[model samples]
Target chain A: MNQQNILFTNNTAQAIDTAINNIRPNGIFVLTDKNTAVDVWPQVKAESTMMSEATLITINPGDTNKDLKSATLIWENLINGGATRHSAMICLGGGMITDIGGFTASTFKRGIKFINMPTTLLSAVDAAVGGKTGINFNGLKNEIGVFSPASHVIISTRFFNTLQKRELLSGYAEMLKHGLIDSAATFHKLIDSDPLEIDAGHMLELLKASVEIKRRIVNDDPYEQGIRRALNLGHTAGHALESLAMKKGKPVPHGYAVAWGCIIELILSHTHCGFPTNTLRNAAQYIFSHYGTPDINCSDYQDLLEFMHHDKKNISSECINFTMLSNVGRINIDRTATESEIKTALDIFRDLAGA
Target chain B: MNQQNILFTNNTAQAIDTAINNIRPNGIFVLTDKNTAVDVWPQVKAESTMMSEATLITINPGDTNKDLKSATLIWENLINGGATRHSAMICLGGGMITDIGGFTASTFKRGIKFINMPTTLLSAVDAAVGGKTGINFNGLKNEIGVFSPASHVIISTRFFNTLQKRELLSGYAEMLKHGLIDSAATFHKLIDSDPLEIDAGHMLELLKASVEIKRRIVNDDPYEQGIRRALNLGHTAGHALESLAMKKGKPVPHGYAVAWGCIIELILSHTHCGFPTNTLRNAAQYIFSHYGTPDINCSDYQDLLEFMHHDKKNISSECINFTMLSNVGRINIDRTATESEIKTALDIFRDLAGA
Candidate 1:
């Protein structure tokens, strides 16, 4: 917890100003992907002074590059830029950038400090709040990492204006999860919003609500020992789908994959956790109608199942999941759904989404 | 803390049997150096059931070889061998193997369990016991690492029977440090032992004492918050000298560099901490008479000092060191020694050691 203030602002310029004035890091190493450097750095540079102490380093964008090679390149950039143990790194892109940059800062000389200025809607709400940083190794996602918090996380809403509609739709899925896990009020707010019409202020508020829900859960169980597992309500299937997408090079945006997985997990919850059948079906239909559906093929079912078994969340060779109950704002982390039930749920989602 | 029933046995065959029956790791990965694999693997193969596990991965040894490349190779081995998250690795060579192997284990899939069965005397006493594991990157020693305890640590003395005399002497320097810090009995034992006549039993006892001393210090401050800086006693100059040696491709064994650094630090302590002049002079003379003198050129002094200034240990730009007084069992950490006094102490050691 070396970070002083975890601040959120709608203006990127103000966020940068607060970071420079409040943190006054020994030096600033702004980390971004090539796409982000192209799309975001102009806004970042326009807001901040070119101090003698700061240097900028850019990584390539996208999940394919979010592996050990990228982390190594980032480390090299830091060293070549004369970054020391006291230097602070600013991760300024999507989840992939944050994951790689945060881990580089955490491991450089045992550790340094870092800040997250997540641009993607998914990352703004999830990756920025959690201290989880990592790089994939050998086909396994997040196989190498440490759970070290950044000094501060600055969430700015300016980037939302530039986000693709599809990405925003994908990100809203997690907002729904926050409601299903602990807050009916937040859920209703999300349901009431015109996803297409939402402005930066509304987006920031949703981000805050979503982050607050996560922070409370993590505060009680930072290391995922028990209660924090509740946060993974849809992630058991979500990660498997993401892994399959990644391996095939189809590469679904992480949030979209999670949204698809949530539909399946909800159906399974109805069977195993005694969730109301209509409530689960309605939620599944809502998500599928909004985010479209994952292109899961019958031919790839076994491969998906294999990926599920290999999910880091699984224990004792079982495709264990943190399924939910019927009530909105309540979930069960300890529930396990059978393989056949999981297949049935996925099949139902495919039929419901007509995919 | 995860590790239990750690053993430092005297027989290699017995150590393997002990690991098999006692620890019962899910899978076995025997880490060996090129030297050990060529000379000792034949005997090791005849003695242990390494192939009983899913696979065996052979890696070249040495500090240069301990890098991201080797980590990748090990990862490939694990994947090919079907090593699950439960799999554990057993490092069976010197300090370099343990550092790299432990780092690989600690980082793969966030982490897996591993054991240290240090073969070299230098590793048996120092590297094996500490939870610190890392690999050098971009010419920086231990540039990337994590502080996670091994599943178990086994420091069998049987390996030391074949250890080169130089390596044994290097490890003995640490034994002397233990004596100087808190153990009069250990100091007496080290002083009395004839280098040629030393046996495995005596080495095991010394290793045990050193481990206990390190363990206590770590328990008080697991994450190196405060009191743990005392461990940096000889590391300031030692690290610089070692780094210089590594860059030169004629790396000095870690203990050799540290031993020389200790003599310099002791002299500086007298000038800065009101240390008795007679005690400082006598200690330098004793080491010079026993271990001969270290050879360092005047041109390298500035380079060494520059390196020390960048050491991860320094809190600020100012260099801090742990220095000792004539009272053999007492040392003061968090002491600041003047540059002139440090130069004078180095000059004195240079003259005494006939550098």
Candidate 2:
């Protein structure tokens, strides 16, 4: 009863309508970002009955806007809109909106029912499923947050179809990860297909299966006390690069960074867990071909390593936490690598990816 | 499985040691406030084997320090001290320390294990239990928060015995409330006793029972979706008066406000829920004789009314939420009274208490 429900529908409006009927909240507020307001909010306004009467609140679009000030603004809006425990909020847009929206809803009068409408493929496969809601605090990415899940996650292809090529690849990268760590057939099919050319229906199916991998792990360990660290597969090196890029004003999409991080981690897997060499090389080639390298050089590796040292998964000692796969669906979580080992892996990653 | 365990120990050092043993953390961080740092931290360092090795972190004491700035300082301190997910933080102080400490620990690395050492009686009976961790934000009381419980609540009277009279009365007021709401016998004994003269062991027993009432309610419904609201009893008006006093730079102890608030809410109980008049008047007499008035008049009623409007329990529509009683042990929750009814209650409260 405390966990989130996954609502898979071909149409967004029907999914939203179903969510509303189930929650039966006394009041409802839908949160969005600037991009979704113009592109997606119109669709909800024209095509949905339950959503018509809901108060629509929009914020600036981007990870930069996901901060305490935005959170404060959302809180003020919720209070002004008269949201209460009996009320429910729908977080619409990409990861940015779902993240800030979930955090705001969870803290508004100590949490109200929230339904997440993750419009972007990246969000649907990642942010919307796990309920790891947060906003960047004091120049740190996702520095302040809580582990409170949404009541429902409404996934549909209506908005995902409209995403740009870069964004599509960003999400596809994670799907590859889902494949490598889950179904080998899924990984093979993903590596074979052109992410940019996949039909919306097929992409939606892939997204659904990929997110299920995360949803299951999260359901088993919502607080990340143990096995949930499996979800951090590529995130250690990935977050470091993402943060450095953001600091340099040349931002990289989350899944893109994660994609690159996967190669390095898989190499480590091959070294430490005796993972198949062919499988690691294949995954690395796929990432490099699609996701592109993070704009980094020898100078940036030290900063990247510094960021890795602060990765949330680390134990009380000086070690980099890693989650690698010995094989598909064979997750090895709660593993650590020395800084020297991690550095060596980074060097190999750069040489192989030609970064 | 996610609930907090309670550890009742006569010796404070033994409680801390047992908590450390139970958690078996990779590292330990002990959080304290100005008062506790001087009064209790020394005892912990000198007597406890597990706590002496802990990193001692202190913040300014009192309710005013229970804000976002203080929380930020705690977070920064935690990061600087290299606290990780395997770490455990012992929150050592009154409600201020436990509330902020619980909040910080829960968010740090998406939550590490935290143990609460409620040094003050008010914290032991109220804030330290029920997982209601928060910090005041946006100039609002506990406006930012999450419902994340500590791993264990270690209750001991070593520091409580040294509490100032006002602080002791603050805790006793909630004990009286627990008595009225759940245990009439407990309520009668509390009313009959000279609160200032209660022995440490007797006070610990009363505190233990009072906290249990709250803990049971929280356990039944942690998010206050239903019956958990019963624990809100006098908090509505009480929180308003407390906030107003803090605003005026003449802060009232939380339990004093609750004691006075209990009289008003009980009066409203008589009006709306058919609560006994003899019981209401006797409670009012006890409050007025001991807790004293909130230092307000007819002019301040509007401010009090304004503050009451912001009470967290109210629903979407404009009405003041009241958790009244038909009689002692007969709780009436999820009840809303008209603004006029609340004003009338306030008026009667002034007349009876001579505020």
Candidate 3:
């Protein structure tokens, strides 16, 4: 048993049952967006059988609303409902909902118990269980946030059935990332398994495995002070691409952007970082074959670099990228890559896009 | 020679000199509100010739703005200014500015260096030195915040020369609190000095003592996981009064609210917490006679109790208050008063007011 009485469960109904039976909170605060309030929250309430005092706050969904304004409203609702430090906030939505809800609970009355009941695949497999909570500001994404552990995390596949194929694929990128950085067996299993066909029978097992992998990484470096930066492998270039897309008001979903970012960075490593050319090419081919290519060109190259400057990982005076080696399961983190090097890498992206 | 590289300086000019010589950086980010920006910031800038890159962000000065929206704007400005982790934030103004700015810096990119240059008499002795950073959420005050240390703090007595007499008297209450809680000598000094006649030279010594007292308390228990609850001696009632004031718009300044709260809690402490009646009488008489009581009646008592429900120090379900003893130089904390007892205390306030 884990020292933290914190349980990780995937079945939403079962998870709520466990929470109710174990915690028996005085009241509940269900956090959702307009989307989840209409679709996902009803399922949660029906299953949990919460009391009348249990509050529901419906907010606007997406990264845009994951901000101070939403947090203030949530705080108002929770406090008005007489929510105390002992009170629990059950976040029931996607990554944006989880981020804002978790941040609110973490800071409201200086931290309260929060549970993430993720509805989207992106949240369930990646964001739901993590303790990171943040909101975007000043054209930079997640510029302000905190590291707050949740009381528990409930990952329900019921919401996965509603996920668009693109959303499911977005989440799969992270799972693939887990495999590339740490586990080959996990990678092979993902390759073999049809995520489109993840049945009820296999759901719990899959969730457990993904969560355990994350747990181990977090356990090793909870504060992101060192080895944790490895987990940000595709993110340096990926965040820039996402922000670029966001600025254009046509933001690509995170996973695809990262998928493309990983491809280019791998090519750069093959040439600049002395990785085996064959392995780098093979990895690039596999991603391209699996997910298609990312769109980019020399014209937008400087824009990508500007986005890189906003990355949280670039703590030093200069912007740095967390590059990778050709060896499967190895990473080179905090490598100070020059602007010229990053531009050359973007050239590969441009080539993928036939730019 | 001590591990602490920066000493808390009394002179604003010298402190700026130290900071400039020590941490030479790209630019300075000075945080202030409309009130402070108009008056305090000009003085601060004049004392220290900031580089051309130094920027100013003026916010609406008040506790209500000390929420997520304010933090988000600050984060946006910092990122837009290309403030990296190396760039330092100099918080100029009162507690609200210091708390919000400190929190913004601490959370911006997972933490950055911040220097507190407090302008208000309240912030000068207390808020400017410690690294307590947070914003209020919902109806809760200081609910969403973190405990992080500052890179350095500069105490400038020059700003107090610009303060209204009422504001000076209000701050004098905290100065008295420091003496009552820890040192009889400091208490006597405050008792002897008239707020109207206080000179900058004498105020600086008192400011240094109060800052040192807070520093010792914080160093002993930085996170307030324990002992530091003693520091909250009057805040239980103080925060409620401040909140009530805020709802009405013409807010009773924080120091004034806390001063009244300290007296209310002191009277109640005598009856239930073994506090000496004489000590309570003396303290109350001194504050009430000097400050003239601000209003707290039965109508607003329930709201005050509700505010206490959100107090950060409450470990369990009960809303506890930190009540001190009659002893000249000691404090008792985290004392839970019954509902009836709190009511009785409110009655005492009403009786005193003849309301």
Quick one: best TM-score, which candidate? 2
lDDT of 3 by residue, A1-355 (tens): 1112345454567766677566666568888999888886666677655623468988998777887678778888877777766688888888898888888787776667777778877787777765778877666777777777666777656677777878887877777677666756776677677666778558667766777777777777776766766677678888898888888888788887777777666666666667666655555665666666655556778898888876877655465657575455666766667788778777765665553
How would the candidate models be sorted by TM-score, starting from the highest?
Answer: 2, 1, 3
Clashes of each: 2, 0, 3
Which of the predicted structures, 2 or 3, would earn the higher lDDT when compared with the native? 2
Residue-wise lDDT of candidate 3 within B292-320, one digit each (tens)?
77766568777777776667665445545
Where does the lowest 10-residue lDDT sum fall in candidate 2 chain B? Answer: B309-318
Candidate 2 or 1, higher lDDT: 2
Second chain TM-score per prediction?
0.90, 0.97, 0.92
Q: After superposition, how far is residue B168 of candidate 2 from its true place, in Å?
A: 0.8
Residue A338 C-alpha lDDT in model 1: 67
After TM-score superposition, the amount by which residue A76's alpha carbon in candidate 3 deviates from its true location, in angstroms, is 2.3
CA shift of B138, model 3, Å = 5.7
Cα RMSDs, all models: 3.8, 1.9, 4.2
Instruction: Single out the weakest 10-residue window by summed lDDT for candidate 2 chain A.
Output: A310-319
Candidate 1: residue B267 Cα off by (Å)? 3.3
- DockQ of candidate 1 relative to the true structure: 0.44
The 10-residue segment with the lowest total lDDT in model 3 chain A: A1-10
**Candidate 2 off by > 4 Å:** none
Query: Please, what's the RMSD in Å of model 3?
Result: 4.2
